[model samples]
Target: MAHWFHRNPLKATAPVSFNYYGVAGSPAANKICNDLRTTRARLLDMFTDITCTPEVMKNATDAYFSLLQSFIVSPDGSTQDNKMRFIQNFKWTDTLQGNAPRHVAQQDMVFELVSMAFNVALWYTKFASRLAGKENITEPEAKDVHRSLKVAAGIFMNLKEMHIPRLITPAEKGRDLEPRVMDTYIIQCQAEAQEVTIARAIELKHKATLIAALAYETANFYQKADHTLNTLEPECSSKWRKYLQLKQHFYMAYAYCYHGQTLLAGDKCGEAIRSLQEAEKCYARAESLCKEYRQTKGPGSTAKPSEQLFFIKLGGLIKNTLEKCQRENGFIYFHKVPAEPPTLELKASYGLAEPVPFELPSLSEQCTPEVYATFDLTRGAKNDKAKPKEEEVKPVKEPDLKPQKDTGCSIS
Candidate 1:
């Protein structure tokens, strides 16, 4: 499963000393700054170990952000005037655009919030990948894999919708915080989550028609995710795009191969043969992409997807089923094959994945009024003067694929 998802490394950041000197403030602010520095360091370190429990990461995240809230806004909902007073420079590297560090010096803490959240989302994806890489995942591990992806998707959406808009400075083009990058992350997480559902359905021996529909929908997700990156530099995105393209083609083959099985069950031998032929074509395209994926330079672990058991199984299944369909058609009904492949089922009534709803935790108890009052709120930061208006990030719109007839058993 590590090989299944293309993950960029977690965004890197320079250490924040959080030193406040010569400024008039309560002594608690100093303790708060120290807490901020230590807690953030712990959270960043946790990401280095994919095996770190989510509970630990969540605790560290809460500890840091609780203290951080005082810097952004007060409990009264008024934007803090001293937001830009924190002299510590927060530097973060863009996950996709390039490796160079981008720094925000006393501009706004919202930038820090957005950058950290992005890294946290990346951690969730890496955690999911670690769970999936297990040689023999138990049922619980499978569900964890699915749940982790949904959480990651939710985090990405949360940042896009809530935090990025609050930044005093807009994210630069090709940066990780850019809307296009966020959209790609959201869609890819969702598609990968649904992949788990498809695998579960197959293990449960659900109906071929149902599985085909789910696979078809999953392929569309991968295609959509890839399309979001189409305008980016080829060298920067080609490797990641190749993964998406391969998954798209591979799932299309999965859909057609399973649809062929369903058609055979219905005694429609000619349509079955056509469906299998389509499956063969898609599988061939995916195979080529697999080769290309291997050769392409990229960040993250190199995966030989073609060598995976899942890939091997699908190739075998398509070959076997196509032969069976052709053999039965010749020996028995001798039905004429359709010139075009039959329409695949588009609406799956069962086993589609959705992102888990997510919201940032409320400001921590450490952000008391006494602490909030320590920072001067009289003068606006220089950066806040005549800020340029930026385009609002549009919410991601998803089509409502209403469930059709239940062609197979449903998962409760």
Candidate 2:
């Protein structure tokens, strides 16, 4: 009986014919027939292993078939009415006749079939949403859905890739090719699966770094923009400090990119690209840095990004500053006066006994022996004539020079 049922159940059943005015060999017929056949086969296989009473098996089979047929006819690809009809008519649990193994298998098969059908219905809803021009989903929602799908796909793909020794696994040893069918099923599941978190993590890490770098670069660029707008020296250190702050932030941004790139290289190509791209943005900020420095100093005082050496070295800073000044003001030239040493001049007082005649050197005559002799001879002659004559000295013999005594006291 089991052999007969397995071989030709349809032939054993009573046949009924109904005439319908429909195209027998049209594209629509082919499409519909294929869908119907596939759906029927899936449901039949799901129930085939059940060890149930004949009536229970018949009712369950008829219920599944009717539901599939209704789905085919429904414009939306799913109908609540069809689901309700299946639920009302199909008593799947009753079909298993106290056979634990068969009951569990049958239940699992039914659950799988129902889930597949539900997925189809959901897909139709998504299609409807897209058709209505309402596909502008939020980022969070999209990310959530994408993440879910990726995870599902990754798991299924992993399962499909699993290899087993044929002798060790029961399914592998079976000649019925159930293992091969299971592998195919896993592959199909993988095809519709979502991406994995590890992959996403790698991708997002790089993206985040890129965004941060972009922000830092943008802020740095804007901070320096004021340099071009102002002409005078910055009154306070605020602008300079701001410029330095920008540079510091930009450095940090680059650091983030570098770190992110390292992390991404492991398994995150997407993230690595993002981080590197951000680093590029930081490099572009050089222009803005120059502009800001020039604004505070002068148009010619613009500093290069690579000119950090000047800030660190004393002489370099002075030289660069001078060079910048010269460039802005054209050639720099100055006439400096030589400093003189201190000296003293001599002058005679008018209270002197002899009128001292100032002797000055003759400008035309050169100092020689004849000039010195003439001046000395004239001076000596004058001194000799003016010599005072000493008269005969009258010598008076002083008798006695008496000592005078004090009036108050007698001479003691």
Candidate 3:
């Protein structure tokens, strides 16, 4: 008899858990929470329909992209391209109702709109990455990369400097927007946006700008997020901490890859090797934390199927990215060293595999090479043949970091 998945008693998959809830007894917060819950359910349904109804998948994806594109072109997200757009296009500025302004509600939609753009960008970016450097990279994949980058850039430009609406206060009541404290949401959006920006920067050979942006974000988020987490209440605190830590480690790994790549772009092989080693260390930490935080829930608990898949795929992606980075940086190693966090005990998680060996293409050769080939930023060197090379950066040794006891680096 042929053996199936169930036949192999030794093969077991671990469960993952997730939950999100609004502040208890607060109507305003409750409504927003309900809206978010509905949104998550609806999006998952749409995705499922697309999967089952393959005949309409392309049409659905196109419509989805168009909706995303409409918002991308309009940073304010005040325009209404589709009736089904997440944010309702309300036009009642300066009108007052009892105590609050009528338009006050609209101010908060910026976060939601930016979030929508971020998700769409993430989806297409993954699609593009899967197809990248493949033997059969079709027009669809190339188009996905182009559209994804556009969305990512749009999200960054729109939200990079945005402030958190002072609407969400620590107390039950609202307060005036604070100017001093950084907006955690925007910081996160911008951090994710850097993935696309860094790739584009490498393609354009602007190593200085890429390194500067990555370094700034990594440091900024670590300091700010660490401070925010210290002030959180007990309820949902651990959940949110896990969420933020995931992003923090991701940014660290991301920075390491580009830092190494920038060195390689300048022919600093030794430095690039060291930077990649740091990246591997970061990835291992992230992998362990990811599995630990989302470890299997006990019986009778419910989590969305789509959400689970996303987390699983994300775990795989980090491993894949690290493997690619190491190969590209010319690192030769035997076994992939698994770095465990000091806090997490050995635990099982979904979709994490040992980093497989693969050949990564040159930085410029991967995605949309024509984007760089057809463009000239310099005034005098408009001709293709006279294109200037980026100035080679000298190799510099980064001071090795001592093992620190506190690993609670994250943004709110």
Candidate 4:
């Protein structure tokens, strides 16, 4: 049994006591905050279970469903502009300490673990669903995953709504608090949500048009969620630093892989190869970060073996697929190793243990530009005026106007 399991076994199923991080005025705020607290606490309990039986897993899914419900937005939602008001507060403290570190609490770490597990569960559900007629997964396993997805979609939709900070800005905030913190949470949630979406895509790979649609959605979501985790680095502790490093780079790499897949689907071989190469590079860094975390933190606290394996296989698949892309392209390019890996930003800035070079090119480079500049006559004239003049400017000529004689018929 894992050491974590011994902490409290029966409490795993007990209801969590909901406490406020700040004052929530409305019924909607109270319900959402209370529910979020309960959900996080419940997840923390299940994460410690060494024997995560099917029954336990089912319970976890149930709890997730309840929590997930709180985040969902209805077109005629009762909680409009009310639930997020408290969370949008600048002085909102989630812990007892006035200036507590973001990742200090057990629940903070466990919430992230829950997110990872939830995504893995989504994959398993879709995976088992695809092979439903086949012999791999039992009927019960398929049912469990299906249920998990129904709940997970709630979380994914919530993340989607909050993809931009403006989306989460509760109309009741009265005054704008520091939105940076909440934005980080939105980013992390969006990334995990996209990963779950990708897993569904992977399971449906046999359908070409469907695969293309999924590929586009996956690539776009991942592209958006990428690099947003960088905000969590300075404000977090070592544990969060490690988790962020592993997740951020891994998803960035995963996003690139999906993009490569998208390109390959479109028969853009050379572009696909370039994207896959970028994926290869980011995955390598993710691998290194994961290793470093294990070495320093011990293998005690992390997602279960099944969850971890999905990403491991994903990394390997990226490698093999990348090689395949290169071979089929009829060209191979070797990347030159930098003399010393570029200094990790977390090391210098936050003093996080990670030295892995995770900073890389963004994948949003693939998106169609919505706004662009096109210079024409006015812009050219402006540019001409902006040039440094060695001599005085000449006076402009005014248009000539001739006076005309008026008809005298209307003398009155």
Which prediction has the highest TM-score against the true structure?
1
User: Which regions of candidate 2 deviate over 4 angstroms?
Assistant: 1-234, 298-304, 308-412
Per-model CA lDDT versus the true structure: 0.77, 0.29, 0.35, 0.38
Q: Mind giving the per-residue lDDT tens digits that candidate 3 earns over 103-131?
A: 22332333334333333333333333323
Worst 10 residues of 3 by lDDT: 1-10
Model 4 lDDT on a 0 to 1 scale: 0.38
TM-score per candidate, in order? 0.88, 0.18, 0.33, 0.38
lDDT measured at residue 277 in model 1 versus the true structure, 0 to 100: 95
lDDT of 4 by residue, 291-374 (tens): 665554311133221134455676777888777777766653333323332221111121111111111112121111110111
Candidate 4: the clashing residue pairs are none
Candidate 3 structure, TM-score to reference: 0.33
Error of 2 at 332 (Å): 61
By TM-score, the better pick of 1 and 2 is 1
Instruction: Give stretches of model 1 more than 4 Å off.
Output: 79-88, 97-106, 377-412
The sequence of per-residue lDDT tens digits that candidate 2 reaches over residues 1-412 is 0000000010000111111113213344334335435545443434323233223433444444443433222323443222111211111111101122111111122232332332222222222112111133344433433333333333223323331221122322211113332232232222222111211332344353343333334333333433422332243233333344445444433434443444343543344344444444544464355456545531111223333321123123223433433343343322121132111111212111111121111211222223222222122222234543432222211122122221111111
Error of 1 at 132 (Å): 0.4
